[model samples]
Target: MDIQTLAARVDEIWAGEEAADARELVKQALDLLNSGAIRVAERVGGEWTVNEWVKKAVLLHFRYSDNREMTAGPIEWFDKVALKTNWREAKVRSVPTAIARYGSFIEEGAVLMPCYINIGARVGAGTMIDTWSTVGSCAQVGKNCHISGGVGIGGVLEPLQASPVIIEDDVFFGARGEAAEGVIIEEGAVLAMGCYVAGSTKIYSVPEGRELPPGRIPARSVCVPGALASRDGSHQTYAIIIKKYRDERTDARTALTSILREGI
Candidate 1:
């Protein structure tokens, strides 16, 4: 069938009254994906548009099914349909040993080191997910990045349209670092070792000369350590910037020293 005809058929199946047939339609779509007849487009505006009958099929499968059930069917379906190009040459650290939950996508050249990549999470090409790291549901990671050991990339799947943690290309996350709740880390960003960044955490910048309020961290900006006002007024938690190292002094020690000297 032609692409347009297939898309129409998929829409019809999804909108059909019967639920069982919808799942079957998804299976047909997967067949198309496996054959390289379709593609999933990641638009600049942050939309993933599927153009192949197979992607439509896989999407429909997840769209109508219960995500809580741990089934090999979904994973097998994706493995058969999702684009394997650009990732075909990618190296996997330990194949057949890495565990990926339902609806998760691990591209070629991406290495999983005994990590848990959960449902709805997508790891881009050449990205290394270190030991014990968690990529939450719907979290989108870009290409050529390094997710260090024990890091948690939070997922926001509830409320449907709510944004998930977005990490762009060439970024590096330190061990035991945490990023949660719709946080957007632009291209080439870096999170220091052991830093914990939440949605409500304010990211203070010394380079941009401004303080980023909750829920947003500017691109290419350096975030240094700072203390937030606690209830007891005794101490505060460390803050960090979510970007790549642009200079030699962008490390945690430099950030702390700068903050103390500047009294910010």
Candidate 2:
């Protein structure tokens, strides 16, 4: 079936309007997602559009499918979703212990190292998901991005309409950094080590001397973890401070060496 028909079927099933067998429809939608033909979300006309039907299909699939034993090398798993296994054909370079669920898409030239990428996540071309990083469901990672070691890119499946974390192109997320709750890290942003930002986290721009809207790290920004004084001056609350926009010096410091990505 075409995307439109598939979407309609899934939506009907979601609304308790379809009595037909849903397994095939759900599988078809998941197959499309696995092949990168459709995404949980996509940028359309400069805005990210959430495909609710696609997400519904994912949830429905969980209901329709049963847990099964799956193995890669000596490791084993029992889960409702199957792991992706077409790395060579997809032109993705995945190192040991890298696990991506069936519905996620890893574009060509991306490298995965000991990472866990949940269903509905997208790792863009030429990007590197470093060791111990977790890319949550429906999170959108852009091209040439560096998700550093131990970073947490949160995902959401509940409340159906909640936005996924969005990391735009050429971003350098430092080690142990965390971006959750639908945060949008704009293009070329360089987050310092250990920085954390959530939907309600205060983001202060030092140059502008003002607080930016929450959950958005501005384009080409250099972000560092900081704190602000409380009203009573008793303690400081965690915040992300934008030191400056990326420049030659910043680029030099955050540049991903070509040598590391040569094979990918």
The prediction achieving the highest lDDT against the true structure is 2
Candidate 1 matches the true fold with a TM-score of: 0.64
Clash pairs, candidate 1, are 29-54, 90-109, 91-109, 120-138, 189-243, 189-244, 190-243, 190-244, 223-241
Over 4 Å off in model 2, which ranges?
158-161
Per-residue lDDT of candidate 1, residues 1-264 (tens digit): 677766787877756645456665565555444333443334356643423333345546666555342335455332321223222343444334456654466765577777877555678867878788998866778877778889998865444434667777767677898888777776666666776777878676666555567765555444444565556988786566434345666533222222211211
Residue pairs with clashing backbones, model 2: none
Off by over 4 Å in 1: 1-20, 26-91, 95-97, 159-161, 222-225, 230-238, 241-245, 248-264
Whole-model Cα lDDT per candidate?
A: 0.60, 0.91
TM-score of every prediction relative to native: 0.64, 0.96
Please state the error at residue 153 of candidate 1 in Å.
1.1
Model 2's alpha-carbon lDDT is 0.91
Candidate 2 lDDT, 1-264, residue by residue in tens = 889988998999999875566888899999999899999888899887889898888899899899999876897888899999978899998998799999999999999999999999999998999999999998999999999999999987865547889999999999999999888998899999999999999999998999899989999999999998877999989999999888899999888876767765
